[model samples]
Target: MPSLRVLNHAFRAWRRNRAWAKHEPETPFLADLLSGAPTCLHVGASDGRHSYVMTQVAPKAVIYAFEPSAFAFEVLKLGIAWHRMGKQVTAIHAAVADKPGELMLVTPKKSSGRMGRAYAYVAETKPNGPARPDLEDTGMETQMTPVVTLDAFCADHAIDRVDFIRMDIEGAEQRALEGAALILDRDHPHVLLEIHPPMLQARFGGSGEAVVDLFLKRGYRMFALDGVRLEERTTLVADLPWKDYFFIHPSRAARLPDGVFKARMAA
Candidate 1:
């Protein structure tokens, strides 16, 4: 029965994808968006790999890359300095959230002496449940980190206009957006974000569509990153129960690459 159940899921996912597929010059979908923008905020910057890529593509753009993990921030800084991107990319050692305060971050337990460092996520309060085995692997531990909202950060820094934002801070997209209401309304920047269906299901009693809805309500359209262009999705499909989404505000939609709608979406 278990084997049959496994087969059943594979078949369903296969059937669902009867037609379709889902990086970069490091990240292709973002090239156009960043080309015209002078300032970009890269939330969940990890070790600054993508931040570096962005700078390479848009050398003049100032990238404010944020990574909450101390372990990760060190690496992020090293990448920026090693590449001599110190002048273009600023590595911020903090988390972007809906509010400015301390929040608990869950990461793999180091005491286990495991060879791999677990992917860390902001541990949400209550009902959301703990991180999954694959994410927290070998168990999880908590470390407190300071978090700030995009709005507050922008205001405090006297940044009047923001053009692009790439945020993928685990499952905290919704909460982070809650705190970014000011930026979204004022800056109207283009965004690239990762939506974890499991994270929504486990933490928000919702699905990936809910995440889409959140952006839609904010006057953004969802698109899957397709090579050098943006492919708008009338129906949201999750390739691996998780994927990144490009949220183009109406103001920026006019700048999307041509040939984006060439192929029809599989019905």
Candidate 2:
């Protein structure tokens, strides 16, 4: 039998595709920015749904997907095998962070030993201290997971070029970006990131603007989906309405079709 989580994922994908068919604007699909034989990273890939989408859109695209949670990694591997996509997607079990080290992954308590919860996050750590183990009250459990930096991973795998990256690592986006600075500088891949303001502040002790600045400082322009059109953003407020954003380097902006963005900020 399929896991309940896997069934839920399938339902969500069906609904999303139904919406797109109705011409309801959702987050712009990866097809908008990807093309032939691109090298991509699906960081924080859970269950490999996005990776499957990548294969559907760009058949020749090679993807390296990283998932930290043991349960999620199992599901991801199952999906890969189910889809027979082993040749195109390489699923690895590890967290992507600012440095290559171990971190505690905190996830909500599950109903059974075999079931898995969603939206697990990196446990908060004190300065020069170990991960906090006081999450019991929050109905969460922690496990130590191997961590790797994008720069080191790419170099180790001999991956010289990256065309696109989609990251949704809970509130650890800033840390992942810090880890990928080398690749960001060299490849300028189109990045799709989800900014969790509450998680950023409460868990990571950071802000959305700080994450936005990470891209702006690197000459990457920010754009957000408004459910109707994409809007270029120069800054983000505390109560910013959107969560997902596209941080496109200047070099890749031309490939995106015209009129898709409002261009609120000059490029």
Candidate 3:
């Protein structure tokens, strides 16, 4: 049995997630794409609220959720068992990067404003930009986490088909994308990423355009949701107005709802 504090935290997290999903424009689209049995990669999975939501929306979806923070990973595992989603959702205790190496995983001791364990991220060097301000007051701790490339992880796990990938690994999106080059080129899975321009520039000396270029060069069209409608994005500026965007390969475009993504209104 779990402790009272753990149970209370779980309840609060569940409630918060429910409220968050209600306003999220991508939630319905996720349901649409994941209605059937699909292989999903949930990078920066935190305490597994999103993975738990995936299980609810797509009962047969096999989710490989990765979280580097030890504290968050424990919470994620507890949630997996609490929800009885252990069979469908596999939690991995590692960070994804461009190469297989080790990085320092920084996590706050408690919730820092709206940010909590979910904001935990791995860095090869000291964090900067938007990540810098948080470190000033938040009691922080670091753990050396083993990093793995998506391409290697999939090849080793024999995941030939990845239907969808939800990545929100702070500023390390580009590196993770680089690591998954093989998967991106071969499977062309639907990628939904949260691109933080300041974080990107601070951590990797890269910008949002660089992240968009990764998909554009691969013949992938990126789209952003305007409330519930999907609008095509031709170019990504250095300052991104939106954080979450969808990167879909031309071949996979047909899988999405024609009415939503087909209109192709420029963003």
Candidate 4:
């Protein structure tokens, strides 16, 4: 049996953590959008932790969180329930791919809260001892799960429009965009995409520049968070040599400061 005081302390800790999950870093980009209380679609929502913030920012906004991993699905469901956001947030057990159908999604058994077949992280190489000492030492197994395209899922669910979209589908950003052609062309939702150029090139035979071209052709501008100015010459470099970068659409360019969107290309 736990003491009453101990139980109360534990409850308080839980509440604090839950609050932290919904509000941390205080992103200026999101803060600007929250003013509109816009509906959001969160792709690659690992456990609904970040999605929880959408609810706090836009109390009336409906949030759709898409995730496919079984373990992550369970965690997201519990997180939604724990946060008591059943009405405000929805958890979709699906992966955002290039088409609207079932596909195998490779999920690593040991993930650092982010892993996907679409985005393959480079294996740390070690000095040659055996045929492949790294492979033998790490022994990481990839888990496959069912995946579907974002467009198909949205059409099936009758979600015609979303005010904001946040995608962090590992390295599947390009394919996910391809699947969301209709939404991109018609609704033109404000998009926040996480780009993993190295993974994109190594796995999909596509380059980050190609992905940027696709969005730019579709009337989207790019931006970097943390108040960095976007310039035509300024490339999207990962914080670390091989990390990830964020891109924003042009229509929502105003949400970011003048320094962020570079020189505002025609939307």
TM for candidate 3 is 0.85
Selected candidate, larger TM-score, 3 vs 4: 3
Clashing residue pairs in all predictions, respectively, total 1, 0, 0, 1
True-vs-predicted CA distance for residue 135, candidate 2, Å: 13
Off by over 4 Å in 2: 1-28, 110-116, 124-138, 237-242, 255-267
TM-score of 4: 0.72
TM-score of each: 0.77, 0.81, 0.85, 0.72
Which residue pairs in candidate 4 have backbone atoms (N, alpha carbon, C) closer than 3 angstroms, thus clashing? Answer: 221-250
In the range 63-161, model 1's lDDT, one tens digit per residue, is 899888876676666566556788889888888877788887876544355423225677654123334532544556567888988889889998888
lDDT of 3 by residue, 1-267 (tens): 556656766666667675664435675666655657889999988778778778877899999999887666777788888778989999999999999989998665454443455556778765443444324435556689989999999999999989889998878899998999999999898888988777677666777888899899999888787666676786663355337888877787666644455445222
Q: Model 4 lDDT vs. the true structure? A: 0.61
Answer with 2 or 3, whichever has the higher TM-score.
Answer: 3
Model 1, stretches more than 4 Å misplaced? 1-26, 109-118, 124-130, 133-136, 204-207, 225-230, 255-267
Q: Which residue pairs in model 2 clash with each other?
A: none
Best by lDDT: 3
Sum up the clashes in candidate 2. 0
Candidate 2 has an lDDT of: 0.75
Best by TM-score: 3
